[model samples]
Target chain A: MTKTSTKPAPIRRDWIAKSLAGTLLGFTLAMGCSGLLILATAGLSPGTRAQFAMWLVTPIWLGVLSGCFFFSSGLRAWLWLGGANLLVFATLLLARPA
Target chain B: MRSDYIRIYKTVHTWTGILTGMALFIAFYAGALTVFKEPLARWAAAPVAALEVPLAETPALIAKTLAAHPGAAKGFQLNLKPTEDEPARLSWVEREEGQDDHDTLSGHHYSATLDAEGNALVSESQPSQLAEFIDILHRVVGLPFDTDPNRWLMGVVAALYALALVSGVIVLLPTLVKDFFALRLGKNLKRMWLDAHNVVGIISLPFHIVMAITAVVFAYHDGLYALQDKFLHNGRLANAFNQQRPAAKPAPRDPADMLPPVTLLERAQALSPGFEPSSLQYVNLAGPRAMVRVWGTDPAALAPRAMGGFVALDPWSGKVLSRDFLPGTQDAANTTLSSFFALHFATFGGTPVRWMYFLLALAGAWLFYSGNLLWIESRRKKQRQGEALPGQRLDTRLLASATVGVCIGCIAGISLTIAAAKWLHGHVADLNAWHWYVYYGVFFASLAWAFWRGAGRAVVPLLWLAALSTCSIPLTTLLAWAVPGLGMWANTSLAALGVDATALAGGFALMWAARATARRVRLGAEDSVWSARKILPSCQGLS
Candidate 1:
């Protein structure tokens, strides 16, 4: 009698990895849209623009914030990105015209 | 600590949803419609003259009325110049305190317009009936007979809405990332419902939060007034509260002997630079106290709340006394408030925003209904298998009834009341009373019907009724046009063709729902009644 091998299906690592990647992309898009809105509406000065640029990329600093919710091997990278973004927004809010 | 917090929030969300879901549904739905209040008003007052009267006309009209009936000129308001599709309406209220006889007229109230000779024109083109009714629905849920309890009750409901929103977010947090775009269809009712509820909730998260917060703010404005009195006013609650209160007694002003209305307008405009006059108010006509107050909008402003400015002018001297322009701080606050309104009304950026909000609002309404379905689907098998305790079955039924009653009830009530407005327009003794009668009458009738007919059967019929009522918007217009006094072609007509067009689009949607429901019923679906059919089959398979 031939024994039919019963093994657990693979974890579909690619799909999970893609989902994580997609989430990061979505986060980026959302941040980009928010930045565009600020530029279009906030009437920022040249100095303010430089400050905002630094803040815009700060989402990467809060890498821990993203991994706190989801379980992924690429969590550390997301955390770093998120941590950076938080730092950027904080700086922008604190920025004053010189 | 985190887990415990999440649990507490979950409980809060569930209880809040249970408590305020019905009221919030009505408020949000009615409010969404109210964003187009002007358009609705125009629709209600169809066939009116597309008059673009000068802002100066209001004071002139007020002067004419005061001259004609001097005793009736206690306090008057300029109805403002109507847009290209509306007629300017002028109205004044006269109050007589301490009248001896019960039958004695408290005060004379008169509204009139100017003729080609600038004489008083007596025509009854009151505010739009439908718009007023919708406003009432939005404000008080049409419960005039029980105002005190209703306000308090609605206030509680608003509080509960905040709780629900917070809890809903908490519940969503765990799966938000994995299921951000996950809309799984087919046979697992619980999963399907969860997906629907989550998708809608998350997609419209910003809108839902705004609605909840604003609803609480609006419904509990009385509380805010109290707070302002307590904290900001240094214990002078009454005085603080009264500051924002609209001027009640129209101070009798001595009308100037003779003054050029255009001059007053020009002076008022000059006082408020870059502001276009929206309305002009003349007080105490023919008396020395006669004054022209010009209300205008600032064009360069981003916020509509801060956009309005006021200039009060002395008709005789054309001297501007008060110029209330939006201050910087006030403008910022007003801008925030205005954004909230813009978000709520979908009028911030104009047409595209309005359409987006409309679709999202409808989706929100769907989310509320589907959330209840998810709860039921999760619990249904237990009841069917006899595994649920005795009270569980009753609980299930009650929830079912409530879900059906509130959702379908609101829809049918709004539709019937709107339709009835046309039927009862000129015949009713009091237009306002008739509006209330129709609204409450339909509401009660719907509640009773929901209870009598099982939720399953009631769903399709109520959907059809709602669809039919929405569909009737265009038909009502056509009927108005066909009827001699009610047609839209007349320059003085109050209804707008845009409203009719909206109704036609709404009708198509209703037809689509009816078809979907019929298909579900044919498929022998469980819980096909209160749940939307498009997602039902997939939900069933999941179960």
Candidate 2:
């Protein structure tokens, strides 16, 4: 990691689009993550599992939202988050209780 | 973090804060007052004649009261220690038909006691809703009602607030170590404001984080439960919580056969020596699953709910049914879960913790207020030494007016309404409705006055108004004692007197603020929106 004189590329701030991406996609991602949690904790009592699932959504959603700006562009954010959402939801569907 | 990431986070923090600052200001301010909701209710409750029913006689009273008012069989309370707010031995509330379950203020309250002849003396009562109303304002960000839509709006604000907090921390990360404790007080006003904001924000970061997360959960818990039911519990979430189901065709039980109040209290205290029983709530007393919840607080452990934890028991058999919510008796998992609620409600550390939360909440409110001030100050168009000052931006002026209006308006409105609880009790036909009117009237009038007169001219008078309104709280108590013919009553309890003392301090603080703000408007920067020398274009020649 040698120091260089060249300036780093300017980050594009498409705030509105990125905000929409974070809000809409971040929620689905939270649901998917919590869904996976529900599947993993299926052996726990129904009440406990339900409590865990319900309380888990806000923190996950906020985490994704807070990290969304790290992506260089809104489209990149949407793409990466959309891909992660698909993977998690697919895993959740396959592993859900019968 | 890269400079660009920091810059991005700064923007995120700014936008999120500007969007939710005013609403959060109201929430935190009202929430500070709500920490003492019980005391406020006690102070506002009209003194009633003593109706002390003996503990041994409660069985007969319950039997007769149930015979006369079968509606209370579904749920009712036996007040073990009746305060001014709950003056009778037996009390219950019946919700109006089709009323929302969350709307506690609109319920029909009833209380019962054994008469001299052993007959149940039942009466309808209207408890003062001043405390409940402020709690509602805190919950729904100053909304008049706690409806689904309002709660969802609160959820959005809470979510944005969470984002603001995180991004604010990220933005301050570069200077975190250097400026952590800096409170540069001299001429650089922006530096001073930033330092103050950072001090409060960073010191209370964990508190704000918990509040933000818990507020979002509270706002959307019903919907969250629905999601959990759909996904995790196969629509049996409620059934899972209630392990025992009442028999569909079970025979009704006799209320008189239940264990006496003394036995119930003894049973509860046996489980935990520190548990102080305040009331016994009987749910489904006539049905097969008749249970009595011994509700109280334990100073040593965290309460699982705002009203404190309870031990549910079978009234007839004196068998403990559930100790999940019993504070000191909870298991590891239950204690861990209850800690969230306890931390949010300040129910773990007793009165000292409550006072700490009250002061922290007020500081949180000041954080928002100073954030807005920093915004306006940053946008100020400084005048050249030899030239006339450039006009401040329209957006900044408008924001200045709005900030003063909404923030000071809430302060003044809440203070005046609290005073109204004592003054307008019997004078108004519906005192609860008058609380709403008085609050919104002051709030909107202050807003209109600020926008009309501009922030500089309106701020001083509004602060004075806030001061006087808050001072009226103690003044009302004084008048009630001094002038007995004025139809006002006062409670001498420490809880009630504490309200007067706190309001007296708050009123004088507002006076000092008014004086300081006046000085700033007259002699501070003339190139700012808070300057008295700057006249609006429309009123340029009036003076």
Given candidate 2, what's the lDDT at residue B347?
91
CAPRI accuracy category, model 1 = incorrect
TM-score of predicted chain B, candidate 2? 0.97
The residue-by-residue lDDT of candidate 2 on B66-86, one tens digit each, is 999999998999988778788
Runs of candidate 2 with Cα error greater than 4 angstroms are: A1-8, B246-249, B534-543
- DockQ for model 1? 0.02
Per-residue lDDT over B1-543 for candidate 1, one digit per residue giving the tens place of the 0 to 100 score:
255446545655666676666666676677667666666665555344433335556556655666777764545556556553235556554566754321112244445677778787654334445664665566654444324456667655654565566567777787778889888987766788888888888877878767665554555445444443343233554542223233565454445343655666677655546566666666655454455666665545332342244566666667655443321212343455445544555534444565676667778778777777776666663324323222335555667777777777677677666655566666667665666676677677667776777565566777787788877766765776588665233223333556667667877887798778766655644433443334433444532
- List TM-score per model, in order: 0.69, 0.96
> lDDT per model, in order?
0.56, 0.90
Chain A TM-scores for all candidates read 0.32, 0.87
